[model samples]
Target: MDPEDGSGWADVSDRSHRIDDEMDRIVERLRDLAHTQRRFQDLLDAVMSVGRDLELPVVLRRVITTAMGLVDARYGALGVLS
Candidate 1:
């Protein structure tokens, strides 16, 4: 008997199983991405700490890099206000 028949047993189809598997894979990928993102944030924080501790010219560059990371932007700039 065809599973699609209205009067047959409530049978799940292979398409549904495939979709569930795809969804599971997507969820797992997102979890891994989140973990990587957290690690990047942690490292950025540590760099900022170093910049603060050293109080050197390179600190400004680190600040710009941190700001760019926050905005998901590839580039950043800093200017003195008049």
Candidate 2:
């Protein structure tokens, strides 16, 4: 069996296709991660702005919400009073 025969070529082609597909998926995930990071940064900035402009209770709530959102947590609490 020659190395360049149909079966060998098909095996190589299949492996190449799988590698390409995996690379494509990895690139897409990286892009999504980058986008999510930028969004998170924006949210952080918004939280900072709220904290700067609002009173203590509002600042604490906004900061907690921002933290929860970034961490994908459904709920959060902060002990800001004491």
Candidate 3:
């Protein structure tokens, strides 16, 4: 029976396997793009939130916390050169 036929076994031809592999790669790339987009949006929102605060300390704390959370870091700190 031809592999292309809707038999119980999957198609094992080289071209078919290559197509499947390419499809899997495309799906993985799309997922990564979606995750990155979400992170970017979260960062943008964090920046906007800090922008609304007029107090310096509050703004600094918000920025540090937001940065830590976005990067999944357990600890974060900010240093001023001046």
Q: Which candidate number has the best lDDT?
A: 3
Regions of candidate 2 where Cα sits further than 4 Å from its true position: 54-82
Note the clash tally of each candidate: 0, 0, 0
- Residue clash pairs of candidate 3: none
lDDT of 1 at 67: 73
Q: What RMSD value applies to candidate 1?
A: 5.1
Can you tell me which runs of candidate 3 are displaced by over 4 Å?
1-12
Candidate 2, pairs of clashing residues: none
What TM-score quantifies how close candidate 3 is to the native fold? Answer: 0.79
Task: Give per-residue CA lDDT, model 3, range 1-82, as digits (tens).
Answer: 4556646345346668899999999999999999999999998999898999899999999999999989999999999898
Sort all candidates by TM-score, best to worst: 3, 2, 1
State TM-scores per candidate.
0.52, 0.59, 0.79
Please give, for residues 1-75, the per-residue lDDT of candidate 2 as tens digits: 367656778878899999999999999999999998998787868666675755877777777877777777998
In Å, residue 27's CA in model 1 sits off its true spot by 0.0
* The candidate that achieves the highest TM-score relative to the unseen native structure: 3
